[model samples]
Target: MQFLEASREQGIVTVTLSRGKVNALNESVIDEMTACIRDLAVDPAVRAVILTGQGKFFTYGFDIPEFLEYGKEDFLRYLTKFTNFYGALFLYPKPVVAALNGHTMAGGCMIAIACDYRIMVTGKARISLNEINFGSSLFAGSVEIMKMWLGQKNAEIAVYTGALYSAEEALGLGLIHEVAAEEDLVPRARRIAEEFAAKDGAAFGSIKKLLRGPLAERIRERERASLLEFVDIWYSEKTWNLLKEKQIRS
Candidate 1:
């Protein structure tokens, strides 16, 4: 795929975000990732999945500059797909680990929070759902997933303040499960994935579904309305101006 690199070893699949340096998510990237995850869902040989990115960013979130060129309807469509993609990942039956190699911001943070486990790299990497800082709002589904991981109060703090957290800070906030040195990031994630993969696949899948199914249904019920509000704000005069100034540096 143009925006991803997928490799499999020992019943685990590793999907790396490979779009330039920051691995910015655009329509094509989301589509590819969604397709890859769907395929892995049905593959008996795939017991677990690891998601990560190359270089200095796990991802910089939505490609704001690219989306700026899209009309409102087009942008809304993409937003719907993006929300659905994360919802799918959130409820994915098999264990999925996010080995956040670097910065995970905005939509990228949404993706990380969807995973069964997250291991962010130590040092310079920061993570945040900082859309509010740029005048953008988040989807209800995303907020629901965040609440599942971070509880109601912490989720409120994250969404309201748009604070950037270092790996250690994110750990303290329960935004990430573990922090690993840069060199150990993927290896540590793989070790966790292996442990998860060793469990009986059917039992794990059933338990996961039981645990997450209700919230997933709620996400589906509320996502359309939330996405409409999100798109309205995204294209508003103030947010548009802020987004115009945004740049994705490779």
Candidate 2:
């Protein structure tokens, strides 16, 4: 794929986002990732998946500059696909772990939180759902997943403050399951994936469905309206100005 690299070892498949240095998500990246995850889901030999990114970013979130050129209809179509992909990942039938190798923000944070487990690299890298900082808003599915991981109070604090959190701070807020040195992030994540892979596949899938199914349903119920609202705010004069100033740095 143009934006992703996938490899397998034993029963674990690792998918790394490699779209430029920042790993920004565009329509193609989203489509490639969705296809990769779906393929792994039905592959009997693939027991678990590890999602990570190359270089200095797990992802810089959506490709804001590219999307800025899109009309509202096109942007809304892309947003719909993005939300659906994350929702599927949230309730994925097999174990999926996020190895946060670097900065994970906005849409990137959404992907990490959807995983069954999140292990972030310590030091320089930071993670946040800082959309509010830029005058943008989030979707219903992402907010639900954030609440599931961070609890109601912490989720409110994270979203409202738009703070960039260091690994230790994120761990304290329950944004990540653990923090590892940069060099050890993937290894730690793989070990966790292995532990999960050892469980009976059917049992794990069934329990995962039971745990997240209701949230997924709620997301489906409310996602369209939220997407419409999100688009309205995004294309508003203030948010559009803020977004135009945003750049994806290497």
Candidate 3:
């Protein structure tokens, strides 16, 4: 739990991403999160789960500098960890809520959409799926989750434009269920979790499966091919040069 903190109260478990500063998703963080979700999903005492972050960032997204040095195999392995985590979150048999304390972008946005509910704090922070700007392809699992949360048209627009939305704008677009002040974010998420937790787990979990199962299957069916295509494009000379220029400038 080096990168995460888990605490339970009133049958709800809160898992906070505590990575330094930006809370970027790297291999270790993703693996830990996948494990966390799986563990909580089966715990009978846990009625709902609250997923959030520490400090000012929910997450800034993938660790670009770490990804920059990845060879094809390394990158594919990394993508596998990422996509598998998304699938786990999407199919977890318990209610999950995301409390966005700050900026949620790229991979962070993917994680937020996988949750059953999303509550973002109003602030200077923005939310976006900025993969296009990074010259990266979206995983099918992530695309399916985004579409499920935001509808197809909004998902298409968000991915195509890489637009960052304020909390109000995100709510208008259906990216988040509610918005609150920074201090109220987790409290709001916990209250929502309590409301959801009152439902019988078996019934709620079954209905969730019925609603999302097809999309999850589609994502699984396309996983391997999508990963291959993404890795190929990511390692191309043009992308390498683009990343190199960005790195030098940074």
Off by over 4 Å in 1: none
**Per-residue CA lDDT of candidate 2, range 30-79, in tens?**
99999999989999999999999999899999998899889999999999
**Which pairs of residues have clashing backbones in candidate 1?**
none
Cα lDDT, all candidates: 0.92, 0.93, 0.88
- Number of the candidate with higher TM-score, 2 or 3: 2
lDDT tens digits by residue: candidate 3, 195-237: 9999999999999999999988898999889899888877878
Lowest summed lDDT across 10 adjacent residues in model 1 is found at 241-250
Return the TM-score for each candidate structure. Answer: 0.98, 0.98, 0.95
Q: Residue 83: error of model 3 in Å?
A: 0.5
Q: Against the correct fold, how does model 2 do in TM-score?
A: 0.98
Pick the lDDT winner.
2
Which digits, one per residue and each the tens of the lDDT, describe model 1 over residues 91-180?
899999999999999999999999999999999899999999889999998899889888999999999999999999999989999999
By TM-score, the best candidate is 2
User: Which of the predicted structures, 1 or 2, would earn the higher lDDT when compared with the native?
Assistant: 2
For candidate 3, the 10 contiguous residues with the lowest summed lDDT are 241-250
Instruction: Kindly provide the TM-score of model 3 when superposed on the true structure, using C-alpha atoms.
Output: 0.95
